[model samples]
Target: MTADREITRRHAGLLDRLKRPELDVDETDDEDLRHLELRRVVLEVAELDHAQEIALVRAAVARFGKAGQA
Candidate 1:
């Protein structure tokens, strides 16, 4: 697999992990921090120069909104 593909895979996996109910809690400081970090990873992965990855990131951000935001 290529670097772009690898990044895409990682991004998708992270998205899947974020979508879990356990990760959706915003009621605690720890949960908020974890959510922020996960979102940071998502945007970082989205910065890659690939069309598919860009689209994936767009969809994710559209669905979840930007990182570091409550």
Candidate 2:
């Protein structure tokens, strides 16, 4: 595939992982590892365009903020 397609696929995969229902962001024994994973993925995704960065932030907020709902 083309480079742009690959980047788009990577972005989609990252966002899907971020929003996956099984993603445990809770404070567990592996919290450090989880943090490192998130940091690594975010840095990788941040290298993409500004629009994608914004989408990533929005998707993260939507996914993580669901716990606060009534």
Candidate 3:
């Protein structure tokens, strides 16, 4: 019917848009890796303290043991 043709046309348009070749240096594209900004803000983690780190390591060992059992 006419509705089916309209749906097919819409789907085709979407497919064409997806198939279109992307620009090598696409600044507007979000996936463009060329202009990626990396920020560093180093903050000390309290959980990484000596005693807490030992506790974390023990917990990880327990979790791994349980995982191996399964």
Candidate 4:
């Protein structure tokens, strides 16, 4: 398969996994859970337009930046 096709396939798989409500938390380790959560976030961000993406980044920074500075 072409690289683009492979990437699209992988993305589809990730989206399917994210949508499943039957996922057992006990079946995955903490790191796997974090990775899945991160994938979900990235997929959500990908749906936003440029302006919305910027707004999300700004909001995230406002919400979490202070904690990092401490």
Output the better candidate (2/3) by lDDT.
2
Ranking by TM-score: 3, 4, 2, 1
Estimate, for each residue in 1-70, the C-alpha lDDT of model 4 and write its tens digit. 6999999999998898775576566655866667677666775657777888799999988879688788
Local distance difference test, each candidate: 0.73, 0.76, 0.67, 0.78
Deviating ranges (above 4 Å) for candidate 1: 20-70
**Lowest summed-lDDT stretch of 10 residues in model 1?**
18-27
Going through the candidates in the order shown, the clash numbers are: 0, 0, 0, 0
| Reference-based TM-score of each model | 0.26, 0.26, 0.31, 0.27
Residue 36 lDDT in model 2? 74
Give a tens-digit lDDT track for model 1, residues 1-70. 6999999999998898774465545468766677678665775656665787788888987868445576
Select the stronger candidate by lDDT from 3 and 4: 4
Residues 1-70, model 2: lDDT tens digits: 6999999999998898775477556577576666578666776656787788799999888878576774
Candidates by lDDT, descending order: 4, 2, 1, 3
Error of 2 at 11 (Å): 63
Name the best candidate (by lDDT): 4
